[model samples]
Target: MSEYEFSSDAALLDGDWVHRTLREHAYWAHDRSREVQDAANAGSRCFGVYERGTGRQVAFARVVTDGATFGWLADVIVDPERRGLGLGKLLVEGIVEELDALGLRRTLLMTRDAHTLYGRHGWEPAAPVGDWLVRWRH
Candidate 1:
């Protein structure tokens, strides 16, 4: 389901299919316009997966990083129609490679689902953030 192509010159960050893809992936997406605008402007490193031959995006993921030691994965999504295809793993594998290239040794994320997928990549549960407000009320 996923085959990531590394591109430093990513397509410009814009609303473009950001929100639509979110909805298509069954994420509780609200305010399509806002979701698109916010994510595109968040300044995170984004990985976009395109369907072979068609060049249409089938998955999306973003990583917020410090470019040195840490990268936190967030907002990983794959279209519902493509769910059984292993697209999510490809998105993450791409992010891992990018962060590794940038010399980041610590990659982190919080997920309530897909634990087995992450575990397959050798990630294990660790202590949660110390007194951190991990949720977004927005």
Candidate 2:
């Protein structure tokens, strides 16, 4: 098993790293402004995955939850340099465990290419493509 450690400490979140990774790499939030990113981090239950000894953040995920019945997982990203190290799976697993502790009955996430990863963690396609609706504002 990998030695990475997962944390739910918003204080441990490296905002600059999160912002840069999302802006430069993640397709979903590439256009998000730094202020918006900060706001989202502030509002969600942010998780940070760190190197075992260095304490450097290498992965991140967040959940917006009501602390009971519903959670929406978002912004799951691993450092590009650390991809294939199983940190993504570790991050997701940690998030799910936290959510389960909250007694959340439903958790949701949208991914363009990671269906298989999430499936292993008990997530299923909540709706078929074109059946879900969004009201994204720019």
Candidate 3:
């Protein structure tokens, strides 16, 4: 098995690596700027998964939370080259575990095509999707 280590420490995160991965791979953040990404990381509870021993960061995620009532999981990305190793599932699981410990009333996330992955970690589709709304900025 490939050993992995998970952490919620922001200081251990590699901002440049994260920017590159999200900008190139994540559909939600393909146009996200480094400045915005850095700011987001600064404000949220960030998580990273590193390959044990090598200390190389292989995955990243963040949660916007009040530490009590709510949280929104966002920017979950694993190195494309490292997919199929179960990193994404493991990362989401760890994030959910942390959120659950906070006693939050609800946690939300939006994904274009990762429902199955998130479903395995206890996430379910929010019914009446129309009740949720967003305003996009161009």
Per-candidate total of colliding backbone pairs:
0, 0, 0
TM-score (C-alpha, index-matched) for candidate 3: 0.94
Choose 1 or 3, whichever is better by TM-score: 3
- TM-score for each predicted model, relative to the true structure: 0.75, 0.92, 0.94
lDDT of 2 by residue, 1-138 (tens): 357898998898999999999999999988999999999999899998998778899999889888889899999999999899889988988888889889999898989999999999999987677876889766
TM-score winner among the candidates? 3
lDDT of each: 0.68, 0.90, 0.90
Output the worst ten-in-a-row residue range by lDDT, candidate 3: 1-10
Q: Tens digits of per-residue lDDT for model 3 on 45-80? A: 999999889888999999999999999999999999
lDDT of 2: 0.90
User: For residues 1-138, what per-residue lDDT tens digits would candidate 1 score against the true structure?
Assistant: 324343323573334566666655534554456656475537787777776566667677777888888878776777677787777777777777777789988788777888998898767887675744666786
Name the better of 1 and 2 by lDDT: 2
lDDT of 2 at 46: 98
**TM match of model 2 to true structure:** 0.92
Window of ten residues with lowest summed lDDT in model 2 = 129-138
